[model samples]
Target: MSATRRQVLARTGAVAGIAFTGSLTELFAGTAAAKGMGRAGYGPLVPDPKGLLDLPKGFRYRVLSREGDRMLSGEGEVPSNHDGMAAFGGRRGQVHLVRNHENRTDAEIRVPAVRGLTYDPEGLGGCTALTLDSANRVLGERVAIAGTSTNCAGGPTPWGTWLTCEETEDKAGTNGYTKDHGFIFEVDPTNPHRTGAVPLKAMGRFQHEAVAIDPRNGVVYETEDAFERPFGLFYRFLPVKPRGGLGSLRAGGSLQAMRVPGVPDLSAIQETGAAFDRVEWVDVPDPLAAETPIRFQDFGPKGITHAQKLEGCYWGGSSVYFVSSFARSNEGSAADHYGQIWRYDPARRRLTLVVVFGPDTDVQLPGEEPDNICLAPSGGLMVAEDGEGAQHVFGVTTRGEVYPMARGRQNIGTPEEPAWGEFAGICFSPDYDTMFVNCYTPGTTFAVTGPWHR
Candidate 1:
C-alpha cells in the first residue's frame, strides 16, 4: 500500500480549512513554550518491539481489524484504504463505528457490495460499519454503504449518522460509473435500515474531502479536496429541515461557498494573526456540477476563496475547525507552508487564523501537512500528520505545545524499500476511554488507550 496523500493526490486532488483566534507559533513565541515543542508531548515514545506502532511510555494499541481479515458478516474481506471514521454508542453497551474505504474501481479489496446497502453496482469505494463491545473487541462488521467511488472522509451528524463524502469528480460514463460519483451519502450507525443507498444531491457535487456539522443549527460545513488549478473551496450547507432529528439532511438543502472579500487564495494570508471579520458566502451556481464543479463555478466579480488540499473539519465548542494540508507556489497557491489550521465561528461569521505550520520547517517534523484533526477530550487538539520521512500523530496542547503522540513503525514495504503508513480516522469512543484510528495502508484499525488526560 502506498501513501494516501500521494495516492489520493496522484489520482485526484487534496486540501484543508478552519480558523482560530491566533497562530500557535505566535502564541508559543510570546510565551515560554518552544515553537514546535517535540519534547513537551506525552513524554518520549517507547518503541514497539513488534514493529507495529510506537507510543508514549504508558500508552498501548491493539489491532482490531485488518484488510485481509474476513468480516463477521461473511460478506467479504475488509476493504483497502481505510480513511475517515466516527464512533457512536449503541444499545446493549456496544459501540458502533462507521468507517470509510477510499478505494476506486481498480482496488483489489473493495467494500463488499452487499445487496441492499450498495448505491452503485459498478463503483468500488464505500463504507463499512463495525460494532465493538465495551472491552474493545469487534462484535460485527458489515457494509454500511457501498457502490460509491472514493469515499475518503465524512462528518458525523448531530442526530446520529455519518455523512460520507466522495473525494472525486468522476462522471458517469468516464470510468464505467453508472451514476455521478462526487456526492455525499448518509450512513446510519445503529440502524442500517435507515441508511438506504441514497445520495444527498442537494449538498452539492464536487471533490469533497470532509464535512463538519453545527449542532445548534444543523448547518453543515464542507471541505473540498480538489487539486485542479484553482484548487478547492470551503462550503456551507443549510439544510431545509435543520437538525429536527435523524434523516433531516435528506429533506433538501442550499449550498454556498465561502468568499473572503478581496482574498482569492487562502494561502495568501501569511501572517498568523490575520482575521476575516466580514466573511461572506455566495450561492453555488451549480451544486450538482452538471457542467462545472463548485470550485470552478463563477462567483461574480468578488469571487470565492480557494485553498489547496482542504482535508478535514470537526466541531469544537461553538467553532467549526478545518485544515489545509500544504501549499506550494509552483502548484498555483499564493504561498508555501507545511500546513494551517483555522477556526470558523459560524455564529459571529468570523474566520480566524489559529495555528500555522511555517513553510521553512523540517520535512520530518510534527507540523508537516496536518490531516484529519479532532478536538482532544482533554483540552487542545489531536492532529494526524501526512508528511514525508517519519509519519506521526501529533498533539497540540492548549499552551501551544507540539508533541508526538504516536509514530508508525509498520514497514508495509520490503526490507530494501521501506514504507511507513499514515494514521487516519483519529476518533475516540463515545466513552472517551479508547481512541479508534486507522492505518491507511494495509488497512488496520487500532484501539488505543493510555493517559490521554495527562
Candidate 2:
C-alpha cells in the first residue's frame, strides 16, 4: 500500500506510463508526459483547472448536466444520483445523451410525476435526455421517463434507444409504492415526449443491473445486481420474433437464466483461471416474478447457476464481457475475489474468466471493483471503479494490463475536500470524438474530448 503510483504499476506488472502524482488530481497530467505510456492509452490524466474531473494532458471535459439543474420541461429540477448512460449521434453535429437517475423514493429530488406515465407516484427514479452540440455544450435537457424505482445501469440498443433497468425488487404497496417496481423501461432519445412509460416485463423482474444485446441475433443479455443469499443470475431474452426491435421485446420474449452444463452451483468458479463447462439456458417461467425473487427460484441453484454481485456488461468483439464486484470467501460464495471480469461467447457457448483482480490490500486499479464498462475503439476497455479506494476509470489493454484513465476531482465541501465518488456510465459518442461519463454524486455528466487513439 505504500508503493507510489509508479511503484504500484512496476510491482503489479500494470501497463507502463502510469505516473505518480502525489495527489489524484495530478494523475493523468504526469501520465501524458511519461515516456512509456505508448499508444495504448491517453497518457496520465491532467487535473481539471476547475477541479471537476482529472484527465490526461490535452484532454478536457465540459460539464453537460448536473443533479439539481433546471429542467427544460420546467416540471422539476434534474434528479440526483445519476447512474448509467448512453450517447447517440443526432442530426446537425449534435448528440443525444440518455441518462439514468438512480433515485429511491427518499432521493433529494424527484423526476416529478406526470400522471399516467408514472409507475409509482412516490418513486423518484427514471431517465433523462439531454441534447449536446458538436462542442459538447448542452442545448436542452428534459425528463424522458419518471415514476420508476432505482433506474440503474441499462444498455444501448442497436436500433437507437436506451434501456433503463431498475436495481430494486421492491414490491408494490410497500414503501408507499402502489405498483410493482422491478422492470426494464425503454426510452427513445430522439423524442422523450412519449405518451406513457413501457416497462419490458418480459425481460424478467429481478434486481436488474445492466444489459447488453448481441448484434448478430438481437438477443438481450441481462445482469442481475442482487447480492444477498442466492446472489444473482445472468439472464437472456429471446424475442419471439427475431429483429423485431423494441416492439418485439414488448410482444413478449422468452426469459432464460444462464447455467453451466453439469456444475449445479457457482462454487465451480473459485479459482483465478477457472473455466466453466458450456453454458445452458434454462427457461424462466414467470418473467414478472410477482412473488419469489427470480434468483431464489428452483431454477436458480438447480437449473441455473448464480454469481455474487454481477454488475456491468458490454458486447464487444463478438463476445459479452461482464463484472462480478467484491466477492469474498466469508460471503459464503465460491471465491474470495475483489473483482472478476468474465467473457461469454454465445457462438461457442462458453464462459471464461478474462480478468481476475486482487490479492492486495490496497485495492488496485484496473482490477478494483469494476462497475460499468465500455470497449474502447482503441483496442482496450474502459472500466469504472466503484471500489473502497479513490475511484477511477481504469483502462485495461487487450492483454489485461490496467492503467488509471481518469479520476473524480470535484470539490463538494471545502477547497481541500475532494468528492471521490464512483464513476458510472462510461461510454463513447457515436462519432467517437467524445467520451461521456458520470460522477455519481451531486450528479455530474462530463463530455471529455482529447487526443484519443481512435
Candidate 3:
C-alpha cells in the first residue's frame, strides 16, 4: 500500500515529535543526496554576483521592488522595513500582493493621506498593494492603507484580505498623535482605490504578531510578539455569530488564551521531543482592555501561559502551525532552545511540538530563529531565518530533511553591515511557480523561480 504524506513524515520523526540529537547539517544526512548537491534541496547554493542573495542551482531571482523607488500610484516613495505579505489572484492573469511596512515611527517615505483611509495622520506604518502578471512580473504598486502603527506579520483571511497586525501595545497620547497602536487592520487587495481601512477592534488588542484562521469554524488563532515582563500569549478568537461569516470578526468575538492542562509553566517544553498536553482556552475578561493593556490583565492566578517570542503562524492540514522564535533559560522558564514549532489541532484540542531546532552547534542548517514560515506549493515548508548569524531561507521536507534554499549576501560597500539581515515577508505567487520574499534592510523584494519540486 502507498503511504500517505503524513505517514511518511511520521516515519522520519518529522510529525511524530521524536527527539533528535545531531548537528544541524546532520539533520538531513538520512535523506538521499544527489551528486555534489545538498541533502534535501536542489544541490548547493550558488552565490550571486550582485552580493544580494544566493540560491540553489537552477533557481534565479529578480528584484520586484526597492525601498526608495517611487510608488506606482505616483503618491509617495515606497516605505522601508517590509514585513508580512500575501498574494491574491487578480483580473486577466494578474496577481495582487498585499505587503506590510513595519514602521513604528516616521519612516523614509510616508503613505499619502487619503480621506477615510487614514487612521492617524502621524502614524508611520501601513501596507502596500502590488499588481503583477501571471509570469510574476511586477506591473504596478500603490498604498492600500496608511497611518497605522508597527504593521507587523499578519495572515491572509479566507475572505480575500490581508489582516495586517500591529506588533505594539502603545496607547493613545503615549507616542505623538492620537489613537491606540496595537490593532489588527484589514486591507482589501482587490480594490486598491477603495479606502476606509477598518481596524478589527473586536479582536483583542495586544502585541499581535501573526494570525491563522480555521476555515472550518471561523476561529482565528493569534500569536503575540512581546518583550515585556509577561512575554507573549497564544490566543484564539471565536466569532460569536458563526453565520455572519468573515464580517463577524469586526462585529465581535470571545477572546481566549491557551493553557496546557497540568503544566503550570511553558518552560516545561524545553526538550527536543517536548510533547504538549491537552490544551484549554480560558476566557479573557476584557478582550479590548480599553483601560489597560491586555497582556497584563490577570486572567486568573495561573494567567495565560506565555511563550518566549511567539512569531510566525500559518494554517496547514487541519492544524495551526506557529513558531516560538526562541526560548531560553530566562526568568520565566528553565529550558533554553533555539526554536520550536508547535502544532495545534483545533478538532482534537491537541498541541504538540512537531520540530525543534537542535543546539547552536548545528551550524550547517543555522536557522537559529525561524520566522515567517509558509507552505511550499509542491510540498514541505519554507522558513525565513531571523537569527544573529548569517541568515538564509531554510527548506524543511516532509521527512524532516533541512537544507538551505537562499542566503543573504548584502553588498559590503553598502551602509548596512554584511554580517546579518533577515529574510521576511515570504509568500508564493498565486500560480505557485514563483516565490516572493523580502530582505529587511536596504529593503529589496525578490521573485524567485525555478524547478520548485525538483
Candidate 4:
C-alpha cells in the first residue's frame, strides 16, 4: 500500500468520486490502461463527469429511481436501503423490476403500506415494482409487497415471479413489531395483489438472505446472513406443491440444511479451486424457529455445515451458486477469509469452490467479498463487492480474472464527509440487454447498458 501502489488504482476520498473528481482513465493510464487491461472485462473504468456512476468505455447508466423521489406510479415516495432485485419482461418489450428495500422500522423512508399489498402495518421492509420502457424510462412504479422486515436478496422464479426474503427473525412483541418477521414471500410482478403478502412460513424463519430456485423440480435453496455464534447454515426447501404458479409455495414445504460430512465450517477450505463432494441435507426440526433458530438447532453428532455472512444466490446451469460474503475468526467463525462463491450440484450432491477471494490484509476490488451474484449475460459471474475496499460490482471471467465493471460513485453523505454505498441486486433484463443494480445506502437504482462481451 505505498503511494506508487496506491497510484496503481488510487482511490482518494474526493475523486472517490461521488464528488471525488479526476479522469479515472488518466489515473489508470500507466498501469492497467497502458498495459491494455481493458480486455479483461470491458477495460478500466473512466471517471464520470456527473460523479454518479463510473463505467468502462461504451457503457452508460441511467439513474432509474432514487430514494425519496416520487414514484411514477403515484404510490408514494421511494423507500430507502435498496438491496436485492430481479428483472422481468413486461408487455410491449417493457421491463419490470421487482426491487427489494432492506428497511427496518426506523428507516428514513418506509415502503408505502399500500392497502391490500401491505403485509404488516408495523413492518417496514418490502419490495417495489417498476415498469420501464425499452429506453429504460420508468413508466410506472408500485409497491409489490410491504410490511415485511429486512427484505434483502431473493431470486426470480422460472415461472415469472420474484421471491423476496426477509433477512430477520424479529419477534413481534419486540421492537414494536406487530407480526413475526423473517419469511420468504412470493411476488408476482404482473399482479401484486395476487401475492397477498403471505409469509411462506414453510421456507424456515431464521435470518434469510437470498434464495435460488432449482427449476428442475422447483426446490428452493436459501442462504442465511447472520454472524451470530454458530454462524449461518445454508438451507434447501422442497415445496409440497412444486412448480405451480404464483401462490404455489404457500402449500408449505419441507425445509432442510446442508451438511457436508467432514466440513463443519465452509471457511476452513481456503483454497480457490477446492471441492467438497457428497453433500447431505437434514430436515429442519423446526422451520418456524418457534423455540430455537434453525442454525442453532441440533443435528446430533453429525452437525450441519456453517458459513459466515451467507448472502446472495442464483440457479446456474444445473447447480446453485451462493456466496459466503466474508468470515473472520475473531468473530467466532471457524476460519477467516475475504469471500467464497460455492457451486452446489443438487444432481450429484456435491459442493465445489468455484471462486475464493483473499485472506490477505489488503482487500481490493474484484475479488473482495462478493455478495449478490448473477451469471453474466456473456459468461462467468457478475459479483457485487460488499467488503472493506471501495465498493464495486466486479466481473469475474471464466479464466478467473477479476475486472472492475462498475464502481459506486454516489455520495450518500456530504462532500466534506463522503460516504459511498455498496452495489447490490445485480441483474440483467430478460433479453440480457440492460443490467440493473442498486446503490444501497441513499437508495439509487441504475440501468446500465453497454456492449457486452458476448
Candidate 5:
C-alpha cells in the first residue's frame, strides 16, 4: 500500500487504551536504574514495545494535569487541545509552566482572566500557568491568564517570558476585537500583574505556529502553520536596535519574509546544495495591513516551495532550524506528503537541508506530517509526529539516529476495548533528565523519565 493510503488506514484503526499495571512498576524502578544505565543512551522510552502508553523497564509517566482541571486561582478548570509549553523557575521550590490551549471561540476553555485581561470566560483557547515539584509533580495551578483565540504554538523569550501565538486568521464577530488573529502575546510567569495578555502587533500577522528568539541579537524567527494550498511563509523580525530587548519587539521593528534568490522554485534546487542561496528580506509596510512581507515566490529542485507550511522553529548554536511538514521527496511522493528540516545559518546567511523525510532507508515510519519540535539536551532533535497510524514522538540525533520516544494511549469511551496512538509536544525539562509530552486528540500531558538506554 502507498504511504498515504497506509496512513489513512492507520488513522482509522488507531485505538486509545490506558495501561495502568506496567506504568506503576516503571515509575518506581525508573530512578534507581538510571545510575547504572551507562551514559544514558537514547531509545524508545515507551514501556510497551508493541505500542502503548506504557514505558520501558525502568521508566514511568504521570499526567501532571489534564484539561478541565480546576486551578488554585479559583478559576474553574483547564480547557482542551493543549499545545506548546514553556517552563520557568518559580520563586519557591516550584517551577512554573506556561501552557497554550489551541481552541477556538466555538470551543472555549472558560477561565477567569488575570486582572486587565479580557476573556470569553467560556473559551478553551487560552494560556495556563502551573507550578510543579522537582519530580515533575503538579504542586498548584492557576489560570495564569486568559482571553485569546486559537493559541497554537509559541516560543520562550530570553527575558524569561512566554510568547504565546494565535494560529488563526478568523477575525470576525466575538473574535474581531483583536486587530488581527495572527499575533504574539507576552506572558510573565513571575509577575502576572505587569504582563497582562496583549497581542504584539509589531510582529506581522500570519498563521504563526512557533517563534524562536535569538539571544545574541533580539531577532525573532517565526514559522507559519498552513498546509492547505499555496502554503505559508517563513519570517524574521529584526528590532530597530541590533541588541534590543524583548520589550523592544512591542515598539516595532522590521518584519521580513524569507525568499531564496535565483531559486525561483524550491523543487528545482532540492538536490543542489545551493550554497548560501542568497536570502532576500522584504519589508512590511504595515504589519497589520494583511500584507505578506515576502517579496519573492519560488521553489527549489525537490518541488518544495521556498516556505511551504513552516511549522515548528528553534534556534540552536548559531543557526535557526525550521521544519516544512509537507515537502515532497525523491521517492514515491505520497498523497499527504513527506516533510523536511532546513537550517538557516546567520553567519553564512544560507539555508541548508539538514534532514529530508520519506523513502529513507533508515527510519521507515510511513506518513509525512510533522508538528512542534525542540532540541533534545542530549544532542539531537525531538519532533512531534502528526501523521496517521499511531502518532509518535520521534527523536532524530545529529548523527541521524531516529528513536520513538512515546506513544499515545487513550480510552475510546469503551470499557470492553480501548485504543492507543501517537503523541506530540515532546519537551525536556531544564535539567533534561525529565521529559514532558503532550497528547493532542486526548488532550493530556505526561512526564516521562527513568534509566534510559539506547
Candidate 6:
C-alpha cells in the first residue's frame, strides 16, 4: 500500500508543539500584504460539507463520466481512479479533454487495457479523451491515449497538445511492460484517431507527477512525487533549439536537476520542520543519461542534499510556480505538511515562497489536505482538496481572497476510501467561463460552469 501523508510525517517524526515562524493569526492577518493582492478575504466561500462535490451559489455541476461507463473504443468500461487532466479546443464547437487514470492492476478496482504501454486485459489505468460542447456538455468519450503506468498530472502545451506524464519510475519488466517507465506521452488533440503513441524519453525518467512548459523558451519544468527515498529533485528539460516545438522535444534535449548553493542539508532541517531562508542555484549535468542524475552542486550546509517532493507546477506571469508538500518552517518548530507554494523566476534565477499552509490554516473545518492546483481565470489560483470528509475546490484570488468554489458529492465512495476525496487535475476552459475537475476516487470528472461575476 502507498504511504499516506500522515504516515510519511509520522515516519519523519513530525509532531505538534513545534514552533512555527508565522503564527496562525499573523499568517491570516497579513494575507493581502504577503500575497501582494491589496485587501482581501480569507475564509471558505462556502461552508464545509459532507459530500463528494460542492460549489458556490448560482453554479452547477454535471457528471462528465463515471467508472464502468462504456466508451466509443469498445472498451468494456471507464477505468477507476482518474487523476490529472488537460483541455484542448476542438473543431465543431467542441473541447477535447485528455484525462489520466491513476489505477494499477494490483488494486481491487480495475479497468482493462491499461498495463504498461500496452493493453493488458487485466491491468487498469490509462488515458482517455472526452469531447464536450462549448456549454460544458459531454458530446462523446473515447480512449484518445492509452497504455501507460499510473498516468498522473500533466500540462498542456501552447501548440494545442496534451502532455500526459507517468508518475512511476519502476523499471519496465518489474511489474508491467518491458518498455521504459516515467516518460511523457504527447497527445494530438487535432487528430484523436491516431493509434500509435510517442514517448519523450529525453525528459528524464523518475517519479514525475506534473510538468509545465515555457512557451517562449520551450523549457519543461517537472516535479517528482517521491515518498520513500530522499532523492526527488526538481528538473528542467531544455530543448536544443530555441522556440522549438513539442515535436522537436520528442527528439531530445538536456535534462538538468535544480541545486541550491550555500544552504544546509534541507532533508535534515525538514525532519525538524525548518524552512530555509537563503537562496542558491546549481545546475546538474546536462543530458542526464542514467535513471539517477548526477549531483553537481552542494547548496545545502551538508554536502549534497536530497530535494523535496514537488507536486503541482504551472507557468504564470514572469515565473514558474511550484509546490513543495513537506517544507519545514525556519524556526525548526512546526512542519508545513499541508505544503508551501513557491515561484521560480528564470529572469532573476531566484526562488521565493508565496504561501505556506499549516494545520490551523488548512485543517479549517475538520480534515482537509491541499493537492493539485491550477491558475484561476481571474489571475489567482484554484486548489484541489485531497483530504478527509468531503473534498472541496477552492479559489485564492491574487489578493489572497480565499473562497470555496465547490464541494464534493457523497454518492461514489465513502469518505474514508483512499481514492474518495482526492481531487487531482483542474483546469479552466479557453473562454474562462467553465471549469473541469477530476476526482481521483470513483474515477469521475465534473464540469462546473456559470457566468463570470467579475
TM per candidate: 0.90, 0.87, 0.87, 0.90, 0.80, 0.78
Better candidate number, 2 or 5, judged by TM-score: 2
In the range 1-454, model 1's lDDT, one tens digit per residue, is: 1354433322221112122335554323222222233334677677789977878889999898989899999999999999999999987778999999999878879887888888889888999889999888889988899999999999998788899999999988978998888999999987776878899999988999999888888899999998767899999999999854777788998999999888889988877667888899889999999998778788998888999999988776678878898888998999887778777888789887777764232332235678988766564567887865456777776665556677777777766656777789999887678888899987889989997656
Candidate 3 — what's its lDDT?
A: 0.74
lDDT, candidate 2, 1-454, per-residue tens: 2224423442233444322111111111222212222455666666567877777778888888888888876877888998999999999999999999899878998887765567677788998889988888888888888899999899988988889999999888888888888999888887765525878898988899999898888889999988686888889999876685644678877999998877654534655446665788999877788778898777744567878889888776577877787666677676666667777888889877756655343433334456887766454567886754356788765545566678776645453333356889899987667889999887999888887663
Instruction: Name model 6 segments beyond 4 Å from true.
Output: 1-52, 107-123, 192-195, 264-305, 327-336, 360-368, 411-419
**Model 6, CA-based lDDT:** 0.62
Tens digit per residue, CA lDDT, model 6, 1-454: 1335543332232323212222222222212212333322232233325444655556667789888787755656787778898887777668888888886646444544532334333334567888888777777776656666777787888888777777776555758665656677777665644433667777877777788887778888988776554446677888776476547676677776665554433333333223344444345543323555333333345443344556888887566767665643452312335556666677777765556544544333322345688766544567775655445566665554455566555445433543335677898777667788887766779887764434
Regions more than 4 Å wrong, model 5 = 1-52, 91-93, 111-114, 119-124, 174-179, 241-246, 264-269, 272-274, 290-306, 328-337, 359-364, 411-422, 452-454
After TM-score superposition, the amount by which residue 394's alpha carbon in candidate 4 deviates from its true location, in angstroms, is 1.3
| lDDT agreement of model 1 with the native | 0.80
Q: List candidate 4 segments past 4 Å from native.
A: 1-38, 359-366, 414-417
Candidate 4 local Cα displacement, residue 377, angstroms? 2.0
- Per-residue lDDT of candidate 4, residues 161-255 (tens digit): 99998989888896788888889999998789988789999998988899888888999999999858788899999999886677889999799
Query: What would the TM-score be for candidate 3 when compared with the true structure?
Result: 0.87
Better of 3 and 4 by lDDT: 4
lDDT of 3 at 94: 91
Error of 6 at 359 (Å): 4.0
Better of 1 and 5 by lDDT: 1
lDDT of 1 at 370: 81
What would the per-residue lDDT of candidate 5 be over residues 15-97, giving only the tens digit for each residue? 22211111111111223221222232343343454333655456777778776667666767766777888777755556778
List lDDT for all candidates, in order.
0.80, 0.75, 0.74, 0.80, 0.62, 0.62
